[model samples]
Target: MNRLTIYTLFSLFLFTNCNENAAEKSLFSASKSPNTAQNIILLIGDGMGISQITAGMYASDSILNLERFKSIGLQKTDAANHLVTDSAAGATAFATGKKTNNGVVGMDAQLKSAKNIIEYVKEKGLAAGLVATSQIAHATPAAFFAHHPKRAKMENIAAQLLTTDVDLLIGGGQNHFEARKDNRNISKELAQKGYQVNSFMTKSLDKIEPNYKDNFLYFTAASLPLSVEQGRDYLPLATSFSIDFLKKHNSNGFFLMVESSQIDWGGHNNNSDYIIQEMLDFDKVIGRALDFAEADGNTLVIVTSDHETGGYSINYGSSRKKFKTGFTTDYHTAQMVPVFAYGPNEESFMGIYDNTDIFKKMMETFGIEK
Candidate 1:
């Protein structure tokens, strides 16, 4: 063959091979890249241990919203100062990635404040919201936005809510804000700060449509809210409403923390029926969150508990429709809680880890450092 013809053929062969390899590399890249979610919905079922979940599933005819999750992990629940962690400290570990003392909210062992994931996300221009069945100033909810040495300081926690950038607030504790020892009308102050504040006494959640142009707040009760069995029925609806409100409030993205707060109360009371009822209610809310995430395809839904309560267990003679349960204690226990995640980057939550890793994984999902 001629020298020019030989060179041309070799160059052509090289180009064809390069093009084939590039196509293969492109396919590999698509499969390997993390499917990061645009929005995150974190659902905290306080004191919901494995037994609690099991009981709920049985009571629901062997079905639960949690069964939808494929990515599951176990989280070690221990406080900085105790083997058994309180909701405040366990939630603080998840919020700030720091293991604080029991009964402390958003503060470390030394009473120093730690910046929570919500604050970090808000600083990045993402909207944040909090919803719970308990008082808004309760330990689990308060840990995300308030810093206090003691979680019992509901009045102080109520004051801190007025200073937060949270776009939506739904729960109880109206009395803490309106009839405080300091006589500070926090609800009025919230309205003055450009929030559209409403209450169960003034307007039901269905009556008040959320407007993203202004912040929203809905007080469910004067103190603690009623249990699901006692006529409280807004949790599932509120979950759906908050997701819509937050998405509209921020075009970039949003972070929402929803709590089925009374599950712990049921555990504290050692009432199996109460736990099952609360669990079923929380499951409905989970279904609502999963519905939004599955449809959007850009939302991550994480469900977990701070710790186990009551050392609860299913006893003998339990059927698929009924649970014969027993409890070892009436307070919190040093038990590993289950974590179930779905949607983009859900795989990151798999496997056992510390409670604080929940915070780390969430930050990594958002491409945030420290």
Candidate 2:
């Protein structure tokens, strides 16, 4: 053949090989292994930034509850509109794999409700839940179900709770659900939706027996209970109930979210005493989850926070009589959060990425279509 014919043949060969490679990539992607993680436990330590972890790790008692996790990951907490993220946007990033505006719930930056992991789980017939120390309508918890322009829209957030397909929701803020001053009562509406609402004071577990199953525990309080070290056993009881609920109803597989909300409150209020106690207390539940994962062997446990509060820092002990102190600006800050994961498929969390990446990681690990 002439030189021109030879050149044309070479170009055709290259194009054909490239098309074949693309087809192979798509085929392998569709055939990835399933049955990786039958169950996932996502724990969010709201406002418990990296400094909070360091403080708690050092100042905490002899044992670290989350020490068993074999893998660790770092998360970047920046909102779509701003580098510093409020609770709503940060939590929404974890829930929906999409950066939304600060003060928005489970919506994209456009203020439209986005498909959170919970919603995706529901579509796959997997059970989902939320347990927190703050109001059920709080920004962190609401991001799983509510979408609105402002995080202050508690009334609408409360209403959104009734519409979620969650198998359980337990936390404080009964007031938001009580009809008052033109606001509707969502508690009554939730009951109508087949949820059994129960109340628990700071240390009241008489309503639920240990190992009890088949019931939802709705503990409504004005604020999260003090840590167990602060003499609040009810918080542990509630945590236990949350685990039991997931194990029972979600035997087929489940996604459980537990929040230690007081970390944020203490961070915001700049109370060192409360922050340490609360962090330690939340650590205990992390212990419980670790225990469960070890036995089940088919679960992945993740521990993380939305963002740092109080600008918490560790002033390493120095011999120069120098001291380390934590400082806060009376609001949230633009800082990177820490993430630790254990059990199978936990390796997906090891890279540096935005908070929304956590959502994608979860979906990828669980084989859920985003």
Candidate 3:
């Protein structure tokens, strides 16, 4: 054979030889035929730990509906400067795949800016959305659009939100973005940008036209819908709304984030009831994403936490005394978080990983260059 034909045959042999393992077969088999993901859905159970997810499973009658996914992984959650992680630093790891110091958002440990996966999706002309159960300006959600060095800079973060061209923005924190004592309401600015900004308390979206295309919908409030157990019927409404909007806009593709923001609150306050409810509610959103993926078959769904809050530990002897009780140190811990994934190329999530590795895995699955 000619030298070129020999080289082509050698390359084909190498590719075929690499597909021996079951995991490899699942990921790259000829029948499986890996394709770039058309839809990406990430569910962040902020502050949820193993105990939190377990308790939620119990509360929901032994079903974490989302756990039905075919693949799973574990991730370490240490921050750059400490054993205990803060929200900003923990979230930055997932957002940029780099460890940043506490209080920094979408920046490195030295406070340098990083382009996050959300920005990457936008560059690819994919619809991007952020959904959280906390103020949209909170650490986790703000990381999507705000690139400031300080997570506490709410006003600046609000202004940054106006600049990003995201397809959808849903969550609480009306105070920061709207009329407040500081006489700053970014909702008006977003409205000027042709976004249908809506405060959560407003009785109606009747003012929003049916054909509100390429617009933002802001559910203004400092926090979101109450815990699931407290208002079980309404728990998944926000998640449903966000997912529906993503499907509508992402005819070509989309990336959506659903965050159950209050799990961290319960951990901070040491309130078991609230944590369980939030977790269950968050799981429901995961179920929603799975349903979408199974139907579409071209979507990728990943579920994980930014970090474990409350230093949550469950004592082995407590099952009898408390039907299992949980205690916390009331702060974030460097414990490893669990990752569950489904849809095409979901097997990539298996094995141990650093929190930043999740970003790399997503990039690999979708073939996006770092």
Question: CA shift at 80, candidate 1, in angstroms?
Answer: 0.4
lDDT (CA) for every model shown?
0.90, 0.76, 0.76
Model 2 reaches what TM-score against the true structure?
0.84
Q: Each model's TM-score, in the order given?
A: 0.91, 0.84, 0.85
Per-residue alpha-carbon lDDT of candidate 2 for residues 1-370, written as tens digits (9 for 90 to 100): 9999999999999888677763354334334553357678888887898767766777764667767766787888989999999999988998998899989989999888798888888888788888888888889989987777788888777787666777878787777777445666666777777676666643355555433333364765754445545676444555666767777776667888888888888788877667777888888888888887766666778999998888866565622223266675757788877789986678778878888888888887788865
lDDT of 1 by residue, 1-370 (tens): 9999999999999888677763354344334655665688999999999999999988886578899999999999999999999999999998999999999999988899999988999888888999999999999989999999989999999899777788899999899899999988999999999888999998999888777889998999999899988989999999999998988888778889999998899999999989999999999999999998877766789999999999999999988867788999999999999999997789989999999999998887776777
Clashes of each: 0, 1, 4
lDDT of 3 by residue, 31-80 (tens): 36564577788899999888888777666765678669779889888889
lDDT over C-alpha atoms for residue 351 of model 1:
95
Model 1 lDDT on a 0 to 1 scale: 0.90
Alpha-carbon RMSD of each model: 6.3, 10.9, 7.0
Where does candidate 1 clash, by residue pair?
Answer: none
* Candidate 3, superposed: residue stretches over 4 Å from native: 1-35, 180-182, 204-212, 220-225, 229-235, 316-322
